[model samples]
Structure formats: structure tokens, C-alpha cells
Target: MFPQSICAVSMEKTSDQVFQIIALIVLVITSQSQNSCTAKTFTNLTTDESSLLRLKAEITLDPDLTITRNWSSRSSVCSWIGVTCSTRHHRITALNISNMGIYGSIPPQLGNLSFLASLDLSSNYFSGTLPRELSSLRRLKYISLWSNGMKGEIPSWLSLLPKLEYLSLRNNTFIGSIPISISNLTNLYHLDFSNNSLQGKIPQELVGMQRLQHLSIQYNYLSGSIPPALFNISTLRVLAFSVNMLSGRIPNDLCANLPSIERLHLRGNRLSGQIPSNLSRCSQLELLSLRSNSFSGQIPAAVGDLRALQFLDLSDNHLSVYFPTGTLPLSIFDISSLQVLSLQRTNLYGNIPREVGNLTMLISLDLGYNNFTGMKTKGYVIRAFV
Candidate 1:
């Protein structure tokens, strides 16, 4: 009986040891699973790191060394220069390296950052065509490649970015016609392709963009009449087509459709025809620059209706007709917000009205090269050529 009791005690000890061994095995499995997850997370981040390293390699010059000195594998990619990461997914979200003087072609591998949203490489020296690989970034929203040396036909694939909104490729060496597919960006707000060597008519298809606010194609080689449909975009605040070869009669109903128009810079174009008298209908008009055009006829009496008018330039035009009484329109001086009023070289024949002094906000007044007489002012300096 004493031997039987000893065997029972030994069996109980063996059972406890088995239970301990099972618990140890379970802990090891759970720990391995947790480590696997951590390793996967790190492996995902390493891809982004590799992509950034490739980009750094393509960048031949970083004038400030901001990218070269900061981007290093010894440190986490999240802390690297110009990179912003998402805290939840641990993925890169934005890369804003604008005005960094980065010189080199953009590495196509950058398209591996599928989670990237905003990419600003403006004011750099990036050259060559945009890589088709960029189309991989389906989540991209804003893109600014302005003021760069990038030369190529603007990629039509840019329209494929589903979430793209603002695109500024202005002041680049991009050649070829503006892509009609850009109109596919229905969500686009501001589209600037200004100051490039791009030629071709402004795509009438762009009128499909209902959300477009600012459309600037100035200082380009664009020719052909302004697309009449562009005026239908009421959301446009600034419509700048200056310094182009655009020719046509200024649409008589110019301001009728542009309710939110603020700055209409049509200067240095070949626009002709009488200045639209309905211009005052654009109640939001602030800067109206019609200089170097062929607009004729008297300044419309409704000009004073633009209470927000700040800068008015009608210089170097064929505006010859004067008011029936042979004097400047009293309405012109009534604009209290007038700051820079330039009517230089416009054919005028009249006595300067005493009402001119009423323009208290006038700063730079140029009335030169006009057939004017009896010009006298009390409070303001005037440059009149009689």
C-alpha cells in the first residue's frame, strides 16, 4: 500500500510537467505570430525606403543637401526630409520637395509609393517626360511640377488619376498641344499650364470641368480664338491668357457668364472689337487688363459699376471715342477702389475732369500719349501727355 501511494504521487508530478510543457509550446506559437506581424510591417516599410533611396540616387544635385544629408537608411524613412507618413498604416502620404533645386530626372520607381497623395516637385530642375509608372498612384490628389525644366508632351495619363484635383505644370518647357484628356479631370479645380512652349488651341473639352476656378495659360505659344465655351464656366475666378497669340473679337457677352470673375488678364493678345459694355456685370471684377489689344470705342459708362476694380489697364489700345461732351467719363473717377489706372496711348481728346481728384485711392495714374488738354489735379500726381 505504501508503494501504491508513491506511484500515485509520481503520476501527479508527471501530469503537472506535461501541462507546463503544453503551456510553454502555446506561448512560443503566440510569440512567433506576433513577431511575424511585426516583421511584415517592417518589410512593407522597407519597400518605401527602397523607393526613396532610388529617387535620391536619381537626384544628381540637391543644392541645399536637405535630401542627401537627411535621407539615410540608418534612420527610419518616416523621419526623412520632405516625407510625410500616415500614422495608422505607416505609409508615406506626401512628398513636398518644391523649390529644393533638385536636379535630375524623376525616378520611375517613385511610382511604387502607391499610397502617396500629394507630390510637389515645383521650382526644381527635373527634366524628361513624366514616367508612365506615375499612373500607379491612383490615390494621388494634388500635383505641382511648376517652374521646372521638364520637357515633353503633357502626359495624357495624368487624367487617369481618379482623385487628382489641382495640377500646376506652369513655367516648364513642356511642348505639344494641351491634352484633351485633361478634361477628364472633372474634379480638377485649378489648372495652370502657363509659361510653357505649348502650342495649339485651348481645348474646348476643358469646359467640362465644372469645378475649374483658375485657368491660366499665359505666356505660351497657344493660338486660335478663345474657346467661347470657356466663358460659360462661372466658377472661374481668374482667366489669364495673356502674352499669347490668341485672336478674336472680345466676346460681347464677356462678363455675362463670368459671375465669379476677379482677374481677367487678356493683355498682349490680339483681341479686337469694341470693349464689351456689359463688363460691369461681373460684379467680382478686380483687375481688368486689356492693354495691347485692338479694343475700340469709348470706355463704357458701366466701368464705374465694378466697385471692386483695383487695377485697370487699357493702355496701348485703339480706344479712341470720347464721351459726347468731350471729357473723361465721370464714372471712371467714381471708382473709389481704383489704385492703378492706365489709359496711356489710348486715343483720347478731352479736358481732365475735376472729378479725377475724387479717386482717393489712385496711386499710379498714367494718361500719357493722349490728345488731352486742361489737365489739372490738386491731390494726385498725373502723367498726362497733351
Candidate 2:
């Protein structure tokens, strides 16, 4: 009986020892797994760092030595100039080297920055076509390559960036038609392709971009009438199609459609027809420039309703008459915010309204080449030339 009892006790002790050993093995395995995960997470940054180094090698001239001196392998790339990294994952997010006077073609290796968001290489001398590899950066939001010497057609692959908000390729030498594929960028708010040689009609597909706020395509060779659908983009704040070959009448309901418009620049075009009476609807208008167009007929009295008008340039047009014969519209002098008023070479025959003194903010008033007589000058420091 004693022997059987001892045997049972020995077996129970052995079972407890076996269970403890199994638990210890599991704890060690779990600890190693966690350590492995941490190591892998940190090592992933090496790929991003390598990609940046490759880009640095491609830059032949950094006049300020900004990138050459700062971008080094000895330190974390996040500390490098113009590089912004996220805190959580230590991934590069923004690269803003604008106005750095650097000269080099953008490297395709930049596409490897999968986490990059904003890239501003403006005011640089970078030349060559944008690499197709850039399409890999699906996370990009803002891209500015303005004032660069980059040649070739603006890449259609830019439309692939789904989250892009601001895109400015202005003052470059890009040619070819503005890509209709750009309509794919639904989130795009500001699109400036100005000062380029881009020809062809404004893409009608651009009306699909509901978020667009500023659309400036000025100084291009783009011809054809302004798309009426473009005026319907109620979110537009500045519509600058000036200095182009755009002709045809300004849409009659232009202001009614663009309730948010502040600056409407249709100057230096061959546009004709009467100034739309709906100009009164643009109560938010700050600048209205329709100079050097073929527009004829009496100036609309609704111009007086633009109380927020600061700069109005209707010079060099064929506006024949103003209301109340031989006198300027009384509302022209009533805009308290009027700063610059230019009615030069419009054959305006009238007496300068004495109420011009009411413009407290008036800085410049050019009524040159008009048939105005008996000009009574205001006491303010306005640069008036009759």
C-alpha cells in the first residue's frame, strides 16, 4: 500500500514539472516574435533612404550646396534639408526644395518615395521630361514644378495621382493640348498651367472637377471660346484666361454662374459683344479686367453694384456711351474700395464726376485719351491722368 501511494505522488510531481516547462518555452517564443517584428519595422526605412541617396547623385549642381552639404548617409534622412518625415513610421512625407537654384533632371528614383505627399521643385532650373515612374506615387497631394525649364508635353500620367489637390506647372515650356485626362483628379482645387506654350481648346472635361477653385491658363497659345461649362464651376475664385487667343462673347450670365468669383481676367483677347448686365451679381468681385477686347456698346450701369471693386480695367475697348450723356456713370465714383480705375482709350466723352472724391482707397485713375473736359481733381493722392 505504501509503495502504491509513493508511486502516485511521484507521477503528479512529474506532470506539474512538464506543464511549467511548456509554459516557459511559449514565453520565450512570444518574446522573440515581438523582437523580430520591431526589427523588421525599423529596417524598412533603409529602402526609402537608399532611394533618396540615388536622387542626390543625379543632382549635378546645387548652387547653394544645400542638398550636397546636408544630405548625408551619416544621419537620419529625416534631418536632411527639405525633407519632412512622419513621426510614427519615420517615412518621408514632403520634399520642398523650391527656389534652391538647383539644376538637374528629376530622377525616376523619386517614385520610390511611396509615402511622399507634397513635392515643390519650383523656381529651379530642372529640365527634361517628367519620368513615367512618378505615376507610382499614388499618395501625392500637391506638386509644383513652376518656373522650371522642363520641356515636353505635360505627362498624362499625372492624372493617375488620385489625391492630388494643387498642380502648378506654370512658366514651363510644356507644349501640346491640356490633357483631358486631368478631369480624373476630382480632388484638384488649383490648376495653373500659365505661361506655357500649350495650344488647343480648354478641355471641356475640366468641368468635372467640382473642387477646382483657381483655374489660370493665361499666356498660353490656347484658342477657341471659353467653355460655358467652365463658368458653371461655382467654386472658382480666380478665372484668369487672359493673354490667350480666346475669342467670342463673355457668357451673359458669367457672374450669375460664378458666385464665388473674385478676379475675372479676360484681358488681351479678341472677345466681343456687350458687357453682360449680370456683372452686378458678382458682388465679391475685386478685379475685373477686359481691356483690349472688341467689346462695344454702352457700359452697363450694373458696374456700380460691384461695391467690392478695387481694380477695374475696361480700357482700350469700344464702349461708346455711358448713361446720362457726356458724363461717367455716377456709380463708378461710388465704389469705396476702388483702388485702380483705368478707362484709357475708350473714347469716353464726359465730365469727371466730382463724386470721385468719395473713393477713399483710390490710388490710380487713368482716364487718358478720353474727351473729358473740366477735370476737377480730388485732394487725395490719386495718380489721375486725364
Candidate 3:
């Protein structure tokens, strides 16, 4: 029995010894796996499907039940409403669910749509700021969230997208300065952030956007001088900076580089100084509103040189330069395209020039509260005071 026990003891392994043997085997196997894996390939996920499904789940209200009833996991993702997929790659390229009256916050998972090019969630009740994760969409081009309840500073990441062309975030509660980095959108054409509570001086860097055409930052609480560089954007077609707290003299060379300008609205601001006499340089100008400003100078005869000038409003300003002894700015009558001319309270006093009859296209003429003894100016519907 003693000899048998000694042999058994010699052959037996302790629990610690067994555990070490198992661990060694596991280490060898794990080392082999590490060597074999050069890169991880994630699978079992349809990127577009997962991202959209997550977004649909966040809708607190859908006015038409468009998303709730139609966005089923059973259907192919391309068949879903507002989703458009590419024929070759079978990837979602556009998601325009605008004006749906749906209420929800944008899901960060939406950034997973690697092929998405256009995203339009405008005229909805979508609240909260834009998801930062949206910056991951390197292929995104168009983004519009107009008339939503979105609030917060405009994201700076918007400048990262190289191909972004159209962007409108107007009619929201966005407050703070217009980002200086917006100049980074070198390829952008149409951009509107109007009707927000944006403040601060207009960024001079906006001149960097050489391709910008229509830029509307009007109806905000923006303060300080209009950036002179903004006038240098020769590509600008519509530049509206009206109804703000902006206070400064307009640069004399305002119309020098602005060859493509059509509408120039700078009304309802605290602007002082003579209206730029170089206005004739804007050959394409159709609408000009310098009304409700503190401009104190005689009307520039250069304004008559605008062959395309249709609407001109110099109303509610101190525009009488000894006009009681002087005649009217008769040069305006030369504009055959003049449609609406409001010179209310401009302190002019003179007999209405018979050339006033030259405005055959004049539709709305408001000469109210100005010192004018007039001959009958005919063919205007909105009154011509004399």
C-alpha cells in the first residue's frame, strides 16, 4: 500500500499546475489570432438601414404618419419615403423629408450614411442644434433646415465639407455671430442665415467665398460696420443686410467691385453719411433701399446711371440739401425702368419736374410729407405728393 501511494503521488498534478497548462495553450491560440488579423472587418450591419431606423424611432410626432407606417424594417431601405439610392452602388444619396411637420431631433446615427449627398429637413418642427456627428458626412452637399425651431450657434464644422453648395438655416432662433470660418465654403453658392437673432459685425472673411452669389443675413440684430470686403465679392447677386443695428458709413466705393449686384437693401439701420455717388457703377442693380437711415446728403445723380434700377427708396432720411431753394433730383426721372420710388420726408421742396412724367413704368410712388409744390404727376397708383 505504501509503494502504491508513493507512485500515485508522483504521477498526480496540483490544481495550480493544471491551470498553468490551460493558460499556456490559450496564450498560444491568442498569439496565432493576433498574427492573422491585419485589420478588422465589421459586418452584419446595413449602415444606411441602421442609421435611418434609429432616426425614425426618435420622432415624437409625425403629422402624416409617413415615417411611422412606411419606414418598416421589412422593406428595402431604398424603397422608403424621402430616401433615394444610387443605381450602381445601391447606397442612399438623398434624404429630403422637408416640410413634413414632423417633430424630432436629428439622430447622431444619421452620420453613418456614408453616401448621403443631400439632406433637407426644412419647414419642420425639428428642434435642438444640428448634431456634430453630421460633420462625418464627407460627401454631403446640400443641407437646409429653414423655419425650424433649431437654436444655438451655427456649427463651425460646416466649413469642413469641400463640396457643400447650398445651405440655408434661416427663420430659426439661432443667436450669436455669423461664423468667420464660413469663408471656408469655397464652393458654396447660395447661403442664407436671415431672420435669426444673429449678432456681431459681419465677417470680412466672407470675401473669401469667391463663388457666393445670394447671401442674405438680413433681419437679424447684427451690429457694427458692414464689412467693406463684402462689397468686393463681385459674384454677389443679392446682398440684403437690412433691419439690423448696423451703424456706419457705407464705403464710397460700394458699387465699384460689385458688378453682379442686383438688390442692395441697407434700410432701417443707423447708417450716416452721404449715399455713395459711385452707385452708377452697379449696372445690374434693380432694387435699392437706403430708407430709414440717417443719410444727410443730396441724392446722388449717379443713381440715374443704373439702367436696371427699378425700385429706389431713399425715404425717411435727411436728404434735403437746401432743397427749399434747390430743385429735385430730376436725374431719377431718366430711369425708364423705375417702378417704385418712395422719397417720404426727405425734406425736398420744389415744383415737381415734368420729367417725373418720364417714369412710365412707375407703379408705387410715395412722395409724402416732403416740401413739394407739384404739378400733377400722372400714371402712378400709390400717390405722388407735390
Can you list the residue pairs that collide in candidate 3?
372-386
Report the Cα lDDT for residue 286, model 2: 96
Candidate 3 stretches greater than 4 Å from native: 1-45, 322-327, 374-386
Worst 10 residues of 2 by lDDT: 377-386
Per-model CA lDDT versus the true structure: 0.87, 0.87, 0.85
Candidate 2, clashing residue pairs? Answer: none
What is the RMSD, in Å, between candidate 2 and the native fold over all Cα?
10.6
Q: In model 2, state the lDDT of residue 59.
A: 86
How close is every model to the real structure, measured as TM-score?
0.85, 0.85, 0.84
Ranking by lDDT: 1, 2, 3
Off by over 4 Å in 2: 1-43, 322-325, 374-386
- For 1-386, candidate 2 gives per-residue lDDT tens digits of 56998999999999999999999999999999999987544434676788788878888899989999999999999998999999987899899999999888888878878888999999999999999988988999999999999999989999999999999999999999999999999999999999999999998999999899999999989899998889899999999998989889878888877888999888988899999988999989999999888998877888999999989988889977744444567877788899998887787776667787888998887777676666444212334321
Q: Distance from true position, residue 81, model 2, in Å?
A: 0.4
- lDDT of each residue in 1-386, candidate 1, tens digit only: 56998999999999999999999999999999999987544436778889889999999889999999999999999998889999998999999889898998988888888789999999999988899989988989999999999998999999899789999999899999999999999998989999999898998898999898999999998889998989999899999999989899878898888999999989998999888889889999999999888888878888889999999888889887766555467888889999888887788877767788889998889877777765443323365211
